[model samples]
Target: MDILLFLIIIFIASILQTSTGFGFSILATPFLLLLFEPMEAIQINLLLSLVISAVLIKKLLKDVDTGILKRFVMGSVIGLPIGMMTFLFIDLNLLKLGISVIILVLTLLLVMRFRMKQYKKRDFVVGGLSGSLTTSIGMPGPPILLYFSGTDTKKEILRSTTLAYYLFIYSISLVVQLIFAGTSKTVWVSSGIALPLVLIGLYVGQKLFVRINQTTFRIFTYIILLFTGLYLLLESL
Candidate 1:
């Protein structure tokens, strides 16, 4: 039953990620935590996310915005350590609640037609925010999603660039978690079993991406953001 449940979650999350480039970790981690220990769940999430990005990188390479990705990486380098510090000292429950609220409110505003003008520097800022969130809360998609959605970035570019960024971030995160937090054998074994499911999900997600238009994509993004926010809020409370 546990394996079946894991397969189902990963399949849905994989489709979301392969299509939109940002939902795998955000949507999978919470449910994974319910079934596995925190360390193991997080390790599994990071590993699978890395695989998703790796699998799609070659295909999406053409759509990637290199300038934005570079800026985001530079800023993430600065934010990663700070996020680790925050993880060590901050009240985690409160942090979760705060992040959840911010995500929910920002997503709502964007849904209501709020716009943020795209500036060169905003990429760095968003990247930094994403990096911090990645380490602190194990979810990095909301910042990038919110930024792109607000700026009305095209679906193709948004999907590709975010996946490119995830390729880098998830790899680094996997290394850091392995070195500092450690993982169980179960995490590896489970991830291995789930690899086929991930691939299936990716294939389906790619198909959906081809068929989805901008408006539909935005609506999907909004729904994911809302779901992530509510999930975190409930967990924290």
Candidate 2:
């Protein structure tokens, strides 16, 4: 039953991620913690997220925002090491509690029609936040999602740029995890089992993306953010 349930979780999460370019880990990680140990769950989420990015990179490359991507990558390089240190020393539940609150508040603000100006270095800031969050919580989508949503970026650019950035961040994260925090064999086995489901979800999700407009995409993103924030809050409690 756990195996069956795990597949379902990954499939649905993959669909959201593939469609929006930023949700697989946010939607999947908390549930994965229920099915596996913390490190194992995190490793699985990272590995699967890498797969999602790899699969979508070719398709989404045309829409990638190179200028934004450059800043995000540079900022992420600084943030990754800090996140690794935090993962080792910080109280994860406490950190998660903080993140959850931020997610909730930001999501609410976005829903209230709050918007942000596009500053020159905003992508860098968002990317740094995303990188730290990725390693600390195994979920990076919230910061980028919030930033893009706040700036009211176009759906195509948002999806492509985020997906492109994930490829870089997820790869670095996996290497860091492997070096500093080794994974058990079970992590590999489980990720292998879920790969097919992830692929299927990606296929279906890409189809759905074609039909979704900006308004629909934003609404969908907000729903995911709300659920993610609520889930993290409940988990922390």
Candidate 3:
């Protein structure tokens, strides 16, 4: 049953991630926890995310603006190490609740029509915070990117740039985890199982991207985030 459920989640996560450049792990983590230890789930998800991102790296290569990726990755480089260190002392459930609340409030603000241009250097700031949250709580970082860049730059530049940045951050964090987190072999093994699911999700999401209208996308994002926020808040207790 757990395996059955994980299969379903992988597809959904990939779709969300591919479509919005985020939400894969945020959607996957709670479900994964039912079958994996928190540390193990993070390890597995990070590995799988790295793999999936790498596969898409070439396609997005030309789209990525190295100038932007540099600052974002630089910010992440600083943030992830600190996050990894902080993870040692924190109760993960508390962290999840905090992130959920933050994202929830942010979603409401998004619904209220907050312009992305209003936040200067926002991607850099979000990348840092997202790196920290990813380390501590396993949330996907690109929504942080989504929130930062305006729709005008979203597809042509921001998404690829964000991917380049997230790649480095997740990789760096993965190395730190391998050395210090002491996740078990099962986590490494499960990542292999999860990879295919990620690919399928990515494929489907890529296919759907061109077809989704803006209004529909906005409505969907709002709905998913509301549910995500509620899920975390409810589980936190």
Error of 3 at 157 (Å): 3.4
lDDT of 2 by residue, 131-220 (tens): 898787788889899999999999999999999999999999989988998889999999999999999999999998999999999999
Which portions of model 1 show Cα errors greater than 4 Å? none
lDDT of 1 by residue, 40-144 (tens): 887899899999999899998999999999998988888776666676688878988998999999999998999999887999999999888777667878899
The model with the greatest TM-score is 2
If both were scored by lDDT, which would come out higher, candidate 2 or candidate 3?
A: 2
Candidate 3 has an lDDT of: 0.71
Estimate the lDDT of model 1: 0.89
Mark the regions of model 3 whose C-alpha exceeds 4 Å error after superposition: 116-120, 142-146, 149-153, 156-158
Off by over 4 Å in 2: none
lDDT for each candidate structure: 0.89, 0.91, 0.71
Question: What are the per-residue Cα lDDT tens digits for candidate 3 across 1-237?
Answer: 377787888789888777765556667877887788878888877887777678777877898878766666766766786677778887766876786787788777777776556343765676677777677766655355446433435453544665666678778888888787877878867777777888888898888877877566667667777777888888787
- Candidates 1 and 3, the one with greater TM-score: 1
Each candidate's number of clashing pairs is: 0, 0, 0
Report each candidate's C-alpha RMSD, comma-separated, in the order given.
Answer: 1.2, 1.0, 2.4
In Å, residue 43's CA in model 1 sits off its true spot by 1.3
Distance from true location, Cα of 73 in model 2, Å: 0.8
